[model samples]
Target: MRSSLMRSLHAAGLIDYYALLIHPLTLGSGARLFEGPAPLAEFELTGSVTTSKGVIIAYYARH
Candidate 1:
């Protein structure tokens, strides 16, 4: 992430200000209803929290 930010800064030329976006990943599990199935973790992905910054504001969101 730092590398990417650095590259972008360099490309933009003297980036004194920057907007950053962060994301949080959440996963859920379901109890095994059948024995012939894979683990619940692999079966489903639960919630995803994402962050996006605009102008000068940063926030997180679920997508």
Candidate 2:
């Protein structure tokens, strides 16, 4: 999903959890997942796993 839409949904309290896949690579710079100014929110890491290919599947619950 687009960052804008995600931000909107989060701001409206429509999001309960987040499942993110993190790759073990990075370029010099790129677009961020959460862009621009947004309401402050907290999340707790509920679970996570690492794939054989070094990908991290992380789960977080909103607080």
TM-score of 1: 0.24
Return the lDDT, model 2, position 13: 79
Estimate, for each residue in 3-56, the C-alpha lDDT of model 1 and write its tens digit.
555555445554433344333433575433233532222122233334362232
Which sections of candidate 1 miss by over 4 Å?
1-8, 11-13, 26-63
Error of 2 at 39 (Å): 0.8
RMSD of each: 17.3, 1.2
TM-score per prediction, in order, is 0.24, 0.87
Model 2 CA lDDT for position 19: 99
Local accuracy of candidate 2 as per-residue lDDT tens digits, 1-63: 888888889888788999999998878888777677767788899999999999999999997
Candidate 2 regions with alpha-carbon error over 4 angstroms: none
RMSD of 1: 17.3
